[model samples]
Target: MEKCWDLNQLYLSFDDPQFSKDIKTLEKRLEDMKSIPCQDVHEDNLKSYLEQFNQFQDLVEKIYAFISLTMSSDTTNQDALKYSSVIETLLASFADTQARIDRWIGQFDLSQIQDSYIQEHMYVLQEIQENNHHLLSDEGEKVLAQMKTTGSSAWLKYKDQLISSMKVSMDGKDYPLTEVLNMAYSKDKDVRKKAYEAELAAYSQVEQGVASALNAIKGEAITVTQLRGYDSVLQRTLIDSRMSQKTLDVLLETMKKALPIFERYYRLKAEHLGYFQGLPWYELYAPVVESHESYPFEKGSQFVIEQFYSFSKHLGDYAKKAVEQHWIDIYPRVGKVGGAFCHNLHCIGESRFLLNYGNEFGDTVTLGHELGHGFHGECLNQQTALNADYPMPIAETASTFCETIIKNAALKSADSTQKLFILENELCDCAQVIVDIYSRFLFESRLIERRQKGPLSVEEIKDLMLEAQKEAYGQGLDHRYLHPYMWTWKPHYYEADYAFYNFPYAFGLLLAKGLYALYQQQGPSFSEIYEKFLSLTGQMSLEDVGKSVGIDLQDAHFWQNSIDMIKDDIDLFEELLKQNS
Candidate 1:
């Protein structure tokens, strides 16, 4: 297998004639669209303007997908980084462009767009109005947007540079931070312990700078949220994510009840690792199985596709196309970034996945995971451009739902040991999304409230973190083992643009589980409803989408029921652990 992605479908080079032509045409379209008079447009003009918007969106998507996917594959590639910078510069004026659209749409009285035919577009119009409050004066918004390149974002880039280049001493040999962090997967216990120490020590080199970056980024978000009249940072996110706070409240409460279950699992693992009192942070991702086997790329790909198809032919077909059609870029090679991500390239009517494929069982799940995202995007292909971008809460619905399918199918088909490994991975990921993510939400919410008083010292931040962990995790984590520096390394905190990014993970997981539960009841025929739900997610409120499938996200019991499903897994895992012992 070639085991790499080819980018020639986009262009051989940015300097290529076709690439230059597309770039010029894109700039020309933006200018052309700006010249069109908005006041003279009636319903027909509004329709025409929206169509042109779709075309512009398509052009920009192709240009961007090419560069971003390339950059992720090789972060150090100078040309890729240059293209990344160029894309940023172009998108910097996004506020200006968006403000123009907002003003144009605002010109139309709601009655004009509320007809039965345009009802589907109500969400799009509502989103614009919701965002309009954040738009400053044209010049002001543009300048502030442009400054982002060298503002908190620049500090973020600096933090990454400092961390990546920093060296750590491990077993008398110094290594880069990336290499040191990978030691968690080592089969040797002593090596894992040493790697943990080395990784922690490496953070010291860039702690202050990263912390300052965090302060600036988070501070900027708080200031802007206040200026925009959002109740809080999380409130702003709820609006952007098309989710309700009530929904979040229910899900958070459910996680609160499930914390002890995850804690029990953690303690069992600790005993296995020969720790009596507390499991150290290094062992958080430690694998317990002794006879580990690696899956080469081919077997891994086949396994994922076969398992997914076993659950649902629609899902299996999409995964197969994703692999066969060059939509996936798999394999661990030099120059690729460390984690995995999927880009739903809506413009090209497809997606691209990037993973540092480590040949672990987890990697198989990851393929199913990213392809699930791609399939979700595929469902949205029927929608208009403006209507196809779903909010964060609903974003993970398909991905997690597909993951559920693979896990359930694997449990049915695998031997006892394989079932244990699969369940462990499922439990591990669920714990992070449910328990760990809740703690992050707690930490960030408190940080925002305290930050309103002004800049917090490092000590104040640590105290806030400690309080948050205690509140969210309860007796689950050994109080001593709770991580304090969590705010420092997690990239979600620095995405100043997207606040309260934590809750959506839980929202996505629980919501996906709820959807999967429905699938179990409805059988294969539920595929039609599932596709409809996915297609509408980009255009409907989270609440509205749930109603399509007889779900009410606002109700606490709906969430409680979904979470209880996970409790079943925990009970089974416990029984198996005890049985094995």
Candidate 2:
């Protein structure tokens, strides 16, 4: 099987004739859209406008996704970078166009629309109307959009460049930052320690630039959110997430209650690592019981396929097709980014995944997580481009649910040591999504609050990061070993548009767990319900989506149930550790 994904399905290369043709076609479409005379909201006017606009959107998605996926796989691809810039500029120029449509749509009492196509898109229409309240005047929106090209957008680009170019010096040799960061998973204590130190040292080269980027991007966000009349950045994020404060309040409260359990797991991990105080940050990712099992690419594929098949034939077949059809770009190369992500191209109805595969068992699980994202795209293929766009929180649901399937299946037949290893891996992830994510949430809240006054010094950013870590990790981590340069590397905090990108991870994991609980009770019959949920993710509010599956997202009891599931795993891990010891 091919190790690299084929983007030929999108275009043979950036120089493809169709690629250029699409750019021209997109320009024409934008011009045509601009020429469409604005009329009073009537069934015909609305339907005609939406039909043309949705088609425009689909083409734009295809063009942008092609450029983005190309850059993600090879960041130094000059053509990809150039085209991405072109597309961003074009889209920024359209901000006023979009705002005008939004304002027009806002004028209509959407409930009065009787057209079938309009009825089909009621949710999208309603969302546009809702967001119209927050939009500025045409000139104002255009100015903001143009300024952002240099402001947050440029800063994000700079941050990516800094990280991509960063190299760590270890033992008189240079290693890429991604390779050194991956050493965190190494079983060799010396390697992990040295890598951690080198990693920290490398940050000095880009720390000030990154801090400035953070300050500028967040300051921009604060300015814009207030200009848009949002009470705070978090409130804007919640509105964008289509989630209410009540739901967030309950989820966070439940997470607070469950924090100490993860703390206990952290302490247990510290004990396993032979640390008397707490697990040192360097050893946080250290494997508890080493498993000799290595899953090479083919072996990993087979394992993921088998586990996915056990869930249902449809899911199993989807996994098989994704691998056989060159849907995945597997393995890391120089200049390729670290970590894994699945980008779904709705226009062409295919998803491309980027993975930095090492022959670790966790890599196999990562495959499952990303393919779960692919499966989500598959379920939404039948929907329109606008309707297929799900909110941040629900975005991770299918991926995490698929991850649960793989991990649970792994644990079923494992020996004592393997069980302990698997459980530790699972608990390790949960702790991050639960406890560490809470730290990020706290840190971001404080960062935004502080960024308002003025640009913070590097020391101030590091101090805030450390303070947040102390509060969230509590005594779970040795105070002396906390990572301060974390704010420099994570891309989440740098996005002015997508602020507070941390908590959605927690929300996604917990919601997936809750869904998994339902699957346990309902069994194979749950597959239909699961697919339905995935399909509606783009159309429904998160609360309504949960209600579709009889879940009450605002109920603390529901979130506590998800936490209880993790606690059970922690309990098993402790028992297994004791028995093995």
Candidate 3:
């Protein structure tokens, strides 16, 4: 019943004696890692280095997750802020050592290694060897790391503070920006319109500051990627994501071909909402059908747990444990970050979720999504720290898969109106992931391209966002009412290392849909295979991971099949809308 998560498992506080001891332990591990001979390629040295690296990563992750999570829920937590910087500095100091070790490992014929432990980590070793092709010199890598602590990293922190502290002025009152944004789903037309206007107006106060941060972070990304010999920021991201450019091209091509189908769904919703021109930006999440059901935290948690259990006991039990153990920090409050994210703390074999729950059916689905991420982490608990880090594209697969489970289950039990509501919700989410995400991809691509020339002014950034929205949404959104300040609030663009973070959501959704289709065909037996797929996510290439489940990542037909699944939902939603009318 607690609204806040317990971080006691990581550490009681920054001042906890164990926290200090761990910091000391981290330093000792760094020293031990530095001692590994860079010239040696023997099994003993390789094994020792891998073990030390894993232990070092585990220590850092444990410390950083606690600090970052604290800051996420309470951005003003000064201790968390301070320790965040301190830890980054320490990690930055390790860059030269890491570069040296990576260079040494890059020299080995990893296939020839016979040790079981090394073989267990062959994929990670292969990645290291591959990425080493772009590795900067030890000193150069160290300098970039040190500079980022003050450059993109500091700008990212500032951007978060600006957004988290922002308040939207509504009818004679101020609300947290997140609370106001969530009002987009309100059934009350006046409330949704006013909240949308207020939210847009509120961004002006921080728009310049946020714009500067974006330019700096993205400018840093451009410089770094160019220095590392990447052709573009997107290329660097694909490499880091362990995805092939061919796969991205095919996925994107399929999405472009399917955009008109989504646009049709949007236009239908607009007509249902009494807007003939197009769906107004504010009405994008508007509920088309009335739903009397209310889902408070407890009810929503139980609903997700039950639905998950319907899939598999292990998954259901994981959700139950997350809720019972206070793994979720629910509800919106001033200083808490907007949006929902599940942070998998592999170091502790647990995950924590942050959600601005508003008691809508959408919020319940969001809970299922985050818990699905937790379940994925649960399946990966047996892997070592180094081997547990999956790529970004695969990151959303489990979460979206869980989301599908929740929506489909709810649809089966709902009355006509409720089914319409649930189906509309699913379609709305898909449109965002596919349609809106495509806009984001375009905006970021253009932004990075422009940022390379110089810093973009606030107006320029807004213009870029609007241009991208128009192109992607086409006739789907009312051009006059489009959200121009989107680039200011989305955290995706500000991360220097994780450029082009938009398409992965689309990837996850389509892939999850494909996997769900497989589950539906195979019945109960597929649960074991699903878990095995999730378990191997950290240890294999994404293509190979898909192969494990009989899904081919490189095939255009596979992605097109997933898009068709959404098209089917759009068809059902259109039918339901006509019946309800």
Give the candidate number with the greatest TM-score.
2
Task: Write one digit per residue (lDDT tens) for candidate 1, span 295-365.
Answer: 76688788888877766687788888888877677877777777888888777677888887877777877
Worst 10 residues of 3 by lDDT: 84-93
User: What is candidate 3's lDDT per residue for 131-197, written digit by digit as tens?
Assistant: 8989999999988887887899899989989998999999989998878987997889999999999
Residues 1-581 of candidate 2 have per-residue lDDT tens digits of 67788898888988899999999999999888776666676678888888888798889988898888888878899999899879877877888887887888888887777788888889888988888879999999999988888889899999989998988999999998878987998989999999999999899999999998999999999999999998999999998999998999898888888888988999998897789798889998998888978889899889999989888898999999999999999988877877899999888888999999999889999999999999999999999877888999888889999999999988897888988988899989999999989999989999999989999999999999999999999899999999998888787998899899998999999999999999999999999899998999898789998998899998988999999999999899889989877
lDDT of 2: 0.90
Q: What is the C-alpha RMSD of each candidate to the true structure, in Å?
A: 2.1, 1.7, 2.3
Candidate 3: list runs displaced more than 4 Å. 1-8, 12-16, 73-75, 161-176, 201-204, 330-338, 356-358
lDDT, model 3, position 302? 91
**Candidate achieving higher lDDT, 2 or 3:** 3
Give TM-scores for every candidate, taking all chains together and pairing residue i with residue i.
Answer: 0.94, 0.96, 0.94
